[model samples]
Target: MSHHFDYPSDETLDISDAYCFAGAGDAHGPRTVFGMNTSPFGAPTWNATGYYELKIDTDGDYIEDITYRATFPIGSDGTQHVQVEQLTGAAARDRTATGMIITPPNAPIGQVVECQGGITLFAGERLDPFYNFIPYPVATTTALKDGTFPDFPAAGPASDSFANTGVRSLVLEVPVKITGREPVHFWATTAYFDKGHNTWIQVQRAGKPNMTTFFDFANGTAKIADYNGTAPTIDLVGRPAHPATDPATGIWGQVRDNIAAVVEAGGTYDQLPHAFPTPRAYGAWAADRLLPNVVKFIPGTVALWDPWCDIQNGKGIIEDIASNIIKMIVNQDFSSGLTPGPVLDYFPYLSTPPPPAS
Candidate 1:
């Protein structure tokens, strides 16, 4: 019901990514769409400050230098208005500066805003970068269970969980100077700006919302390090009663730090950039009955025949196509990162073809 981060194990979460440099709306552009998420519990869209940022490491050791922040605030009409700012000099060093909305857009949403300094932040819908299995969350267990997490395979089909349903996302397109804060081998994380007095607190980083994901203390342990003990440490589900505490994690603060470290150390992708493979990766990872139908569907979607979404078939149809062909791309010569693929370029967004033999 409330906002929360998507999970790595959930069948419906959109946690995939690619590399990129600059950002844009034509998304016919943008170097890459590294990650995305639209949790499947399905909530109507509401207002939330969304942003994408990068931590620059002008200094040594790959730790974040000054962090760049982008906040997306929507106007009453629902068009995305944006603000961009850097937390450097006295700003980042001072905790007090963190709460200041440094770059408020002037002239409102007239396609331009003098966002602090001279950075002009633009807001609008671009082709969602993250991809995953769709319609498969509701699919049969056996249907989606393949390359997905070992214990859960059926979570294969990935979809842009956000769609139009109101997943107000925060995307930050940092210039290479800033993102280089980490090594090419550094880390990436996504979070919402805490508007509450305790706003600096990244809630998604603190404790994910319940009913949104199957990830927990143990889920992190198995995939990465033994951060949590042997049993699954489900968080925030009942809360207050069960309260989202992790005894293995000593204090709530430690849990967040522990999770970030685990993934960071392992060089593994977490939460967003749903990079992990699942049964939904391939079109056929659906239930047996639907299995025959994926091959029957993708090849046939061009013929005006669509896959079914009901119990018997049509399970991972949307998810598979989006990932395999829709999201794939090759990096530019500069390694600016992933760009739209030639195949996606050739195909009509409906049913198109790969570029002619390159």
Candidate 2:
């Protein structure tokens, strides 16, 4: 079996990406969107049974500062219920919701549900706005599995496979005051309250666009459940000594060591000093970007240098960084796939899925 098939499980959570962007003209308000592509063809709807959580870590510590838990009870006619809870400090255990129920508009296709206090919520299918060269994945997966570790290059005119596909999205719009400060981080997950264990268990999660797609989980399937269950605060260094490793004692030291080995063995590209001092430094830097599993949304800052561009927060810049690292496996550039579209100006912000082929 191919390494790609060997790892990454059954794609129970094909989350392409999650986004947080500033609202347009204050009419829409600041927005956070979570997207997931269901696997196994036509599985149960995400909200049909369990909890879909949009977690925000406001302080850059990779811990949840606010958690929005959206639940769809078995008996609901069609409406979904959501609870917003704020967490504080290092432990991040405190959770308190304002006792609000955010309802979706009657019609979901283009409907935007405005909850009390200027909060808006939307849930349904929309075109997947994220794009990247399809060739990039093929090249990297081959290299990582074969241990060749060649230099992957720029997109070179490659197209996006996901461009025509759609992802189920959960969007929330809130006032600026709630976002706290600039450079806010966001991630999303699906969890179910397990009656047998009497605890909420996470089945899937995503943060930065391609964290799990590239990084190796040394322990593989043994620790994958733990990886999903835990928050992103754990550093990406080495295999955890056990499945229950603490976030504070994460294996960052092991990460640096692994990077040293790869760099020394000529498995990775040379350092780009603007980003890091050495390959090991770059490894740690990349780990920080990936492990947090949070999207950094910077308000008032133009992430993409284009005209009439809505704030992409840090998504564009992060995609660029992800592109740069991809060059390590093959020197291709896929920037053409990252163009802006009409989706930026709409209510359910993603672009419309490509029409079915004749």
Clashes of each: 41, 17
Cand. 1 TM to true fold: 0.38
**Candidate 1's error at 282, in angstroms?**
24
- Model 2, span 1-358: residue lDDT tens: 0111222333434344555555543644444443333332222354455656677777777677766666544334665444333334433333223423445433243356666556667665666555556566555544444444534354255655555665556677666666654677777776655689767666666655444555444432224455556666665434344322222134343333333334444534343322344555544443443445556776544443111121224444123334544533232222333553347565555665456556
lDDT agreement of model 2 with the native: 0.49
Q: Write the per-residue lDDT of candidate 1 for residues 1-358, one digit (tens) a residue.
A: 1113333333222222212222332312222111222332332331244434433334433334455555556678766555555776446433345533546643342233334432333332233332333432222111112212121134533434533332223233333333332222112233443556554422222111111222233423322112211111222221222122223232222233333232333333322333323212211111111111011111111211112222221112123322222111100011112233212331111112112222
**Each prediction's whole-model lDDT (CA):** 0.28, 0.49
> At residue 187, what lDDT does model 2 achieve?
76
Q: What would the TM-score be for candidate 2 when compared with the true structure?
A: 0.71
- Each prediction's TM-score against the native? 0.38, 0.71
